[model samples]
Target: MERLCFGIDIGGTSVKLGLFTENGNLLDKWEIPTRREDSGSHILEDVAATVKKKIADDNLVRENIIGIGIGVPGPVTEDGTVINCVNLGWGIFNVSEETEKLTGFKTRVGNDANVAALGEMWQGGGRGYKNLIMVTLGTGVGGGVILNGEILTGSNGAAGEIGHITVNPSEEDKCNCGRPGCLEQFASATGIVKEAKRLLDKSKEPSKLREIQHLSAKAIFDCAKEGDALANELVEELCRYLALALSHIAHVVDPEAFVIGGGVSKAGTMLTDLTKKFYENNVLFALKNKDFKLAELGNDAGIYGSAKLIIGK
Candidate 1:
C-alpha cells in the first residue's frame, strides 16, 4: 500500500480534512460542518471516524497511514494542549492525545496560523524561501512566521502574532483578543469596514459606498474600482496600516519575503501593489530589500501545513 497521511484543520464553522502522499501531493480532500457545542471532544471524534472510514474505503492499511496532524484556531501549548479557543468553545484540550487514542495513529497539533505558515513554506508562495512570514487578513488579522525553513512556535507556542501588533498605540479600537489598536483593528476586512463607516459617518468624502447599507471590505474595493474617491482613500489608508505592521515585522523577523493571504488578499494585485508601495515607504532602509508576495495556496494552506507537520521534523 502507498504511504499516506491525514491532515485536518479545525475551524469555527467547518473542518477540512485531506489525504496526502508522502511527498505532499493532495490525494483526496473533504469537509464537514463544525458543530460547536460545549467542547472539542465531539469534533475530534468526528474527525477520527471520518479519516478511518476513508482509509477503509480506499483499502488502505493502517500502517500505510503514517500519522495525523491537526491545526486548531487558538493558542496551543508546547506539548500539544489547546489552552483556549474562543471560536471553538474549547479550553485546555489534549487534542493530540485524543486524536491518537481515537484513530490509533501518532498525532501532532499546532496553531492554525502556524500550520498555515508551514503550509506556505512547504508548497505555497513561501516555497523555496527559507524564511518567510504569512499575514492573513480576514474577519480578523492573523499571521504565522517561518524561520530557517521551520515554523517558529516560540517558547510558549504562541509566536508570530503579527495581527496583535499595535499600529497606532494611542488609537483605541477593540481587538478580538481584547486588546486595543491592534493591526487587525484597522487592516482586516472587518477593520476596513469599520474605517469605511467612520469615514461615512464623518462625511469626510463623497462616496458611492453609501449605497450599500451593509458595507464590506470587498464592497469598498468594488466601489474604488468604480471611481469612488472615499473608497479609494479608505483602501489607501488600510494599505498604509498594513504596510506599517509589515514594516515592523520586516525589521524584526528579517524574513526573505512576506506573504499576504486570506480573503482580502483576493483583492488580487490591487492590494499587493498598494501594499508594496506602502511597505517600501515605511520600512527602515536596512529592510527595504525584502520582497512582498501574495499567498498562492489561498484557502488550502492550513491543510497543507498540517500535512507538512506529519511528514516529520
Candidate 2:
C-alpha cells in the first residue's frame, strides 16, 4: 500500500483534516466540528476516531501509515507541548503525546500560522523559495517565518507572532494582546474597518464611504479601486502599516519573498502593489525589491503545512 499521513488544523470552530501521500499529495480532506466546550476535551478524541474510521473504511494497513501532523492556534514547544491555546481553552500539555495516545500514530504539532507558512513554502505561493514570511491579514494579523525550508520556531515557539509587533507607542486604545499600537491593530481586516470608521467620523471629506451603513474592509478597497479619495487614503494607510511591518521583519529574516494571505488579501494586486511600493521605500537597501506574492493556498495552507511537517521534514 502507498504510504500516507494525516494533517490536522484545529481551529476554534472546526478542525480541518487531510490525508496525504508521504510526498505531499492530498488524497482526502474533511472537517469536523471542534468541541470547544468543556475545555475542548472532545476535540482530539473526535479527530482520532475520525481518522481511524477513515483508515478502516479504506481498509488500509496501519503499518503503512506514516504519522500525524497537527496545527493549533498557540505556541507549541519543540516537543509538542502546547504552552497555551486560549482560543481552544487548552492549557500547557504535550499535545503530540496526547494525540499519539489517542490515535496510536506518531504525532507532531506546530502553531497554525507557522505551519501555514510551511505549507505555502512547500506547495503554495512560497513555492520555489526556501525562506519566506507568511502574512495572514484576517480578523487579526497572523504570521509565520520559515528559514532554509524549516520553521524558525524561536526559543518560546513564538518567533512568528508578528501581529503583536508594536507599530505605535502613543495610541490610547489597546490591542487584544493588551498592547497599544500593535501591527494587527492597524493592518488587519478589523483594523482597516476601524480606521475607515475613524476617518469617516473625524473627517468631513466627501466620499462614497459615507453612503454605506455597514462598512467592511472589502468595501473600502472596492471604493479605493473606484477612485474614492477617502477610501483610497484608507487603503494606502492600511498598506503602509502592513508594508512597514514587513520591512521591519525583512531586516531580521531577509527571506526570499513575503506571501500575503487571508480574507483581506482578496483585494488582490491593489493591496500588493501599494504594499510593495511602500515596502520597497523603507526596507533595508540589500533587501529592496524582494518578491512579494499573494498566498495561493487560501484556507488549505494550514493543512498543507501540517502535512509538510510529516512529508518533507
Candidate 3:
C-alpha cells in the first residue's frame, strides 16, 4: 500500500488541503472557507471534521496517512506557534497542538510563504536546485530561501523575509509593517497598481488603463502589450525595483536560482524577461549567471509543501 500524508494551507479567506503520496504525487485536493472570524479552535474543529470525512468518503485507511502538515499565512515560531496573522485575526495560535489533539494525528505547521517555497523546492520550480530563492508577488511580496538543500529558517524562523528588505530606503511610502521602502512597496501587485495609478494620475499618455477608473495589474499588462508607454514604464520600474532587491538577496544568499511565484508570475516571460534584465544590470558580477524562473506549482505550492513536510522529502 502506498503511504500518504495530508497537507493544508490556511489563508484568511479559504483553506486548501491536499492528499499526497510519499513520492510527491498529489492524489486529491479541496478548498474550504476559512471563516476566521470564528474562534481559532473552532476553525481547527472544522478542519479536523472535514479531513476525517474526506478520508472516510475516499475509503482511505489511517495507516496510509503518516501525519498532517499545515501552512499558515503568518509568522509562526520554529515550533509551530503562530505569533499573529493580521489578515486572519488570529493571535498567538498553538495551531499544530490544537490540530494534533483534535484529529489525533501528528501535525507540523510553518509559515505559508516558507512552506510554499519548500513545496517548489521539493517538487516544483526549485526542484533539483539546492540553493534557491522563491519570491512570491501577490497583493504583497513574500520570500523564501533554501540553502544546502534545506529550508533556511533562522534561529527565530524568520530568515527568508526578502520582501521586507529595503529596495528604496529613502522612499517616504510607509509599509504595512511600519517600515518605509520595503521591496513589497515596489514589487508587489499592489505596488504595481499603485505605481500605475500614480502614472495615470500624472500622465496624459493614451492608455486603456484610463478606460476603467479602477484598473488591475492584468489590465495594465494588457495595455502595455497594446503599446501603452505608461504601462510599460510602470512595469519596467517595478521590475527595476525587484531587480535591485534581488541583487541584495544575491549578495547575501548567493542562491543558484530564483523562482518567481504568486499571481503576478502569470505575466510569464514578460515579467521574467524584465526581471532577468534588471537583475543582470543590478546584481553583483559574480552572481550574474543565476537563473530566474517562474514557479511551476502556482497556488497549490503551499499544500504541496505541507504534504512534503509530513512525508520527509
| TM-score for each candidate, following the candidate numbering | 0.94, 0.98, 0.93
| Candidate 3 wrongly placed segments (more than 4 Å) | none
> Relative to the true structure, how large is the alpha-carbon lDDT of every model?
0.87, 0.92, 0.86
Comparison by lDDT, 1 against 3, better one: 1
- Per-residue lDDT of candidate 3, residues 64-161 (tens digit): 78989898877777677888776677888688889998998889888889899989998998988888999999989998888876677777667788
TM-score of candidate 1 against the unseen true structure: 0.94
Candidate 1: segments with Cα more than 4 A from true spot: none
Model 1 / residue 163 / CA error / Å:
1.5
- Model 2 lDDT-worst window of ten: 304-313
lDDT agreement of model 2 with the native: 0.92
Off by over 4 Å in 2: none
Candidate ordering by TM-score (highest first): 2, 1, 3
Candidate with the larger lDDT of 1 and 2: 2
Tens digits of per-residue lDDT, candidate 2, 69-177, equal: 9999999888999988998999889999999999899999999999999999998999999999999999999999999999989887898998998877787899998
Residue 56 in candidate 2, Cα distance off native in Å? 0.3
Instruction: Please name the candidate that would achieve the greatest TM-score relative to the true structure.
Output: 2
Ranking by lDDT: 2, 1, 3
